[model samples]
Target: MTGNLHAGALLLAAAPIGRPEDASPRLREALSAAPVVAAEDTRRLRRLAGDLGVAVTGRIVSYYDQNEASRATELLAELLAGRDVLVITDAGMPGVSDPGYRLVREAVAHDVRVTVLPGPSAVTTALVVSGLPTDRFCFEGFPPRKAGERSRRFAALADEPRTMVFFEAPHRLAATLEALAEAFGADRPAAVCRELTKTYEEIRRAPLGALAEWAADGVRGEITLVVGGAPEPAGLSDPADLAAAVADRVAAGTPRKEAITAVAKENGVPKRVVYDAVVAAK
Candidate 1:
């Protein structure tokens, strides 16, 4: 219903994260009315359609990660032919750590109209439910698979003030939590949401260290992790305090210049202030 009349529009549909009942009415209509439906998993699409009691009259094609690039071209052709194409993933919105991004990019390149049928989102759902600050937040879809890369990524984000949301596989949950605790400190608050909106939905809120221990036993189902932002350091205005903070980092093998910058950022002070304090302490 939201596409251009002359050229077929690309519709990005958001599927329910868990329950079929959470699917939007617009999505049901799109499934029935679109000329072509590109689904990440054709079998899951059919099952979802059946659950909604709607018969899909459109041509359903597989558009998963393996076939995403090659299939995007075919779907784009359908759009140029004035046939509306609806993209749906296994759960949640398409192009969100899922297939459909390539097609959306191609469609835009060819001047194809694009629209969205928004519904449930695991990112926002997990953020609100986690009781973390919602005013500012970011979604980090998944962490690097390698231990070294993951550690570096977390280190870079250690000073990020906005709440962070992440999606992760069950098998990697324990290791990821442990790495997070190391990077963000064991006392940092976080929440692990599993099987959101499902019958066995669970949310565990605790310090990063405790959650790491809890996940060591293993977990199942989909996972969304929400971690509170780095807390601002308090009452470290004294030059001796700043110098001591830099000295501690230097003793731990961090470069003096880097340590000064880090301490300044962490305490909401200027780099010059920290540098001057370090020099004066010498």
Candidate 2:
């Protein structure tokens, strides 16, 4: 019976990341035009429609990450019946670090045509407003909340040449900037964009060290940090100097694991060899 149904179509609609007034006319029309609206949070979706003065004509259903797996088949069923299934996340584009990835994957598997409605994006908004170099950049999504894991992740990004953008909670902004300073260097240029595109929007551009100090006082609203990457180091290709760095950190009370990470990052060498050498010495 499912095989006999017409091909399904999935609509990925971008939601306002911060403000309701940013809703595009097309988004409002889609809200009223879709036969079914799959929302990350149906109540919030309804509220948004109310604020936009557009009544949703379709049935509203929850389709977030937790339920996406079990609900995909059902939503696909509705779509296959020639219903326009509009997928809206709580904010921003549906699949960008949001709940729509799984459903989109399922839709593709079912031979359903999928397209997006471009609208307000926190990533791009924060990047341009940040006053940092944006000629080459990459969206890092969000960093790990746990400090240890977050440190490790930042360490891995030490060699990234282009500018980087990341989403962070306001509460964690200080610690994240501190880690960026340690991994990238205190003198590296950076920008902290808070409450972007909202009435309280703020952008602070400074060295990572200074920004970390400023964020220590506490900031609110959604936060995005654009950080400069590790600069090309001088004499990084010297093996003996790299080995000496490993030895010095170990002498300074850094653990073998931590020391290896620090030295490999400083020398632009892979950590495996340094780790193997430390293990051999032990």
Candidate 3:
């Protein structure tokens, strides 16, 4: 907001998600420059500072979800006191799945100027490497952990045309994949991105079913999943049940290119025939 900016500056810095070496030079400079540092995990922050060989002269304070509300007023007070304050989360950008959202919102409401230190983010990184359509996309964040809620959640996004991205825990990855397969259909194209920029980083592109089966053995580390979207609706020339199968895949998460390929391959028909039918249907 204008209050802080007019008075001084409040910086929102992005912390490394996994690899500490990803720390930007500006971030390191900001760490030492800012007088007060509000960190999600002070211990980790201290360790990062040590690794970077930067001595922080700032007064470190904890600002996590549990204490953010009460701490916000104090942090804002620091800004109002004409002290430059820097906020950092444990990983990635703050507010995506981290702290600092409330403080930022309050700062804006109170006319305190807010600035962000742009850096690595799992959401965008996963999307670009996902190999799905990237022209248009939406980050769904993390899906519900429970089976019932998770199933219902995936059911809602069954027809999302843009590439969809989600964060999943390693232990829950298998169940999540299975649920996606059932909700979006087993054959829908998808990719699982794990350990983003870290050394063991891996991106597996395959149908949802194949990933689900692989996850049965259990996958670990930070997981980002990108699922293909609903396919264009078309008709079949099976003379028996072309429209039904096409509609099923379309409702699931099969795009035109994939749907045409899968339907023609399954029904013993020409790909052009299915493509024309879909175009006419639309």
For candidate 3, the 10 contiguous residues with the lowest summed lDDT are 1-10
* Model 1 lDDT, residue 51, Cα: 100
Residues 1-282, model 1: lDDT tens digits:
344457798999999999999988898899999889999999999999999999999899999999999999999889989999999999998998999888989888788899899998999999999998999998888999999999999998887899999999999999999999999999999999999999999999999999999999999999999999988767479999999999999999999999999999788787999999999999
- Pairs of colliding residues, candidate 1: none
> How do the predictions measure up, each by TM-score?
0.88, 0.81, 0.80
Give the higher-lDDT candidate: 1 or 2.
Answer: 1
Q: Per-residue lDDT of 183-248 in model 3, one digit per residue for the tens? A: 989999999999988889999999999999999998989898999987765544653355556767
> Of the pair 2 and 3, which is ahead by lDDT?
3
lDDT of 2 by residue, 1-282 (tens): 243248657899999987899999999999999989999999999999999999999899998878988888898888778887999988889888777888778777777788899998888887888777788899898899999999999989978988899999889999999998988789989988887777988888999999999999998888888887666756445555556677888799988678888887666667886666556555
User: What is the Cα-based lDDT of residue 175 in candidate 2?
Assistant: 95
For model 1 the local lDDT of residue 133 reads: 94
Worst 10 residues of 1 by lDDT: 1-10
The residue pairs in collision within model 3 are: 1-111, 1-112, 1-113, 2-111, 3-111, 4-112, 231-254
Which of 1 and 3 is ahead in TM-score?
Answer: 1
